[model samples]
Target chain A: MLEELTIQQKIKYLQDTLYVISGKWKLLILMSMYGGTCRFRELQRSVEGITTRVLSKELKELEVNKLIERKIDNTYPVLITYQLTPYSFSLKPMVDEMITWGAQHRKELSKP
Target chain B: MLEELTIQQKIKYLQDTLYVISGKWKLLILMSMYGGTCRFRELQRSVEGITTRVLSKELKELEVNKLIERKIDNTYPVLITYQLTPYSFSLKPMVDEMITWGAQHRKELSKP
Candidate 1:
């Protein structure tokens, strides 16, 4: 049997998962991937405000976590694209809820 | 009118929201509250092994974020309890999804 984590260890494990997806642009990248697989430049355009550096970093982190898969296409010059893994797609509902919640909260903020 | 945040600003704003809820124990606290308003001791028990210090700190932070409300019951001695605010309750679906997702992912982890 796999060892059971202590409460502290379980909490730490949860925290680590949060940390992996904790960046500003990570969810936006996630949201973007919902449309289709995206080339590096396509993601930049889709998210529309992330800098190259932060996007690169967030993509690398997601890739490392196995939430995203990067595929290289060698048709002439190499083209690279990112797509959500099945694991990553599992988070779609959470991300959508966040977006919906954000919209509602934003509406409230506009109240006098 | 509040100025529209730049793309960089928008990303940062989204990230800040994530950071506020990103703690390991935060969702568990939210989950426990679903049962009912939780006395401090009750929360400690429901969560099953969070340090008193960390619980106190997390409670304070949740209060600061306006996601939870703390009430002091003055029945002879003082009793403190935490309850989810409407805003916090709005997160119920998201939290539920996380728990469900975690369970599914855990099952996958156990597969050879």
Candidate 2:
């Protein structure tokens, strides 16, 4: 159980995970790339209101963590595709649970 | 897949979960209570570096979300015990995954 864990262990666990997805952008980026590969511009467009600088930074972090893969495609104009790695799918259950909880939260908020 | 969710849907999902555990303290608080009931001072001591003000705020939020239960014990002085609800255990897998990933991250950082 988590109670018996030392503060040092808990803090390290907290830091690493928060360090990876601390900001608002990373999870959004992950959601955008969940279905299939997305090009840079497509991802930028998908997340809505995320600036290129922030998106670029989140993408790099996800890539470094191996949650996503970035590939270069030499089409007419060339494209950089971002897709989820098998490792990232580990997040599926958590995200799905969030979606369920989020819907319920919205419902609760709307009650008069 | 999460990819297929519309931005509106994704945002709602993201906001709901983040709303629940957005900060450093919430998860740690959850971790501290994972094993069994804990008193107010015990949680504050377990988390380390958190102030009384922040602790109260986080405790209220967690209670509102139904992730934790609060009960008052009228002893000589009075004590409040915090315990995780079944709903909170839904987060067990995600926290465990974070702990695993965090350890790997620390190991990677320590590698020469």
Candidate 3:
């Protein structure tokens, strides 16, 4: 059985999770991959307005964190795609809740 | 009826939520006050190791976001206590899940 973490340890852990997913385009990247995997251009189009550099950087971070996996197909030019790992999929509900909460609060926050 | 927010709007909204809830000790503050409203000193004790300045700043931010509210007791010396707002209570599940996730990931990260 895992030992219980002290509150201080817990806070640091949360901070680290935030570190993995905290970039501007990280969550957007996750949301875009929700339906399934997609190629580089497809992901760029899915997010809309994200520069290629930023998107590339975010993808690298996600891959390093093991939240996403990249596969390459050796064809004429070669094709690469990205998808969420099972661990990343486990975060789906949390992300969805954040989306729902965002929708609910947006209107309330817009006024004044 | 509320219209669906554009993706950009949604991202901004989540960032806003993070802004409201972010800070070093905010979660700990919320967790400490979890059982009931706590007097200033009690809150300070609950979180442990937080400086008075940081506690004051975090409490003020929580009050501004309506996540927590303050009540004063009429006595020889005025006493102020803080409690979570109903809206804040709604975030309990999210926070608890975050705590659980943090625990699960902490072990994995410490391995390296």
Candidate 4:
């Protein structure tokens, strides 16, 4: 499929994808939520090194992109949680490939 | 494989990959080389909108990462060309997945 794309189209497609997922924290935040729905504090804890403010912004962006859903439970003490949407699964192949490549890269770099 | 990883390890792996490929221009420069080896001027032209200075920097970084080789032919006019290293092909699976997801993302965003 990539072979079928002209260079211009390929670049545009790559740009679109990167715009949604390229960031220090977006993918990490999403990875954290993969286990189950997570409240804001839980997410902050799970995605270590993420500040509360940064996590809030990343979650909002993910929600706007439809990659995640923010659910609110209106109890005596309101509870809000974030979870991956079905659409987020679209990233699984790419993410898997990245992990495979990354692990290999680490090994390659460690060669004596 | 990803499921087996603790969250910390997963995040580290992801970060390792992103450090190499996450950027506005690195992948674009790489995509241009997929056709074949190219001289600096040719690459700058093919990767539209890239300045000579930026392209030079990107090429040097790619060489440092061992993703590309910069060969200088000490002929009459010094024929310098950049080509992808075998290690770079390891990125093919990830790049293909990105292109696939990227095209789908463009379509998704165009919904009425």
Candidate 1 Cα misplacement greater than 4 A, ranges: A1-20, A35-57, A74-79, A108-112, B1-20, B39-57, B74-78, B108-112
Candidate 3 docking quality: incorrect, acceptable, medium or high: acceptable
Model 3 quality (TM-score): 0.67
Candidate 1 CAPRI assessment class: incorrect
2 or 4, greater by TM-score: 4
Ten residues in a row with the worst lDDT in model 3 chain B? B1-10
The number of the candidate with the highest lDDT is 4
Top TM-score prediction, candidate number: 4
C-alpha lDDT score of every prediction, in listed order:
0.71, 0.79, 0.74, 0.87
| Model 4 ranges with Cα > 4 A deviation | B1-4
| Candidate 1 residue lDDT tens string, B1-112 | 1135354444445555566676567767866686678898889998877999999999998887678899988877888878988878776665555545554565555666
- Candidate 1 residues A23-62, lDDT tens each? 5567778767876789999899888778999899999988
Model 4 / residue B91 / CA error / Å: 0.7
Q: Fill in the DockQ of model 4.
A: 0.68
Candidate 4 residue lDDT tens string, B1-112: 6778876776788888988887788999998898989999899888878898988988888887789999989999889999999989989889889888999987776786
Per-candidate interface C-alpha RMSD?
A: 6.4, 3.7, 4.1, 1.3
Supply DockQ values for each candidate.
0.19, 0.34, 0.26, 0.68
Root-mean-square deviation of Cα positions for candidate 3 versus the true structure, in angstroms: 4.9
Position A36, candidate 4: lDDT: 84
A best-first ranking of the candidates according to their DockQ comes to: 4, 2, 3, 1
**lDDT per residue (tens digit) for residues A13-61 in model 2:** 7677777777677888887786798988899998889999888988998
Candidate 2 clashing pairs?
Answer: A35-B3
Worst 10 residues of 2 chain B by lDDT: B103-112
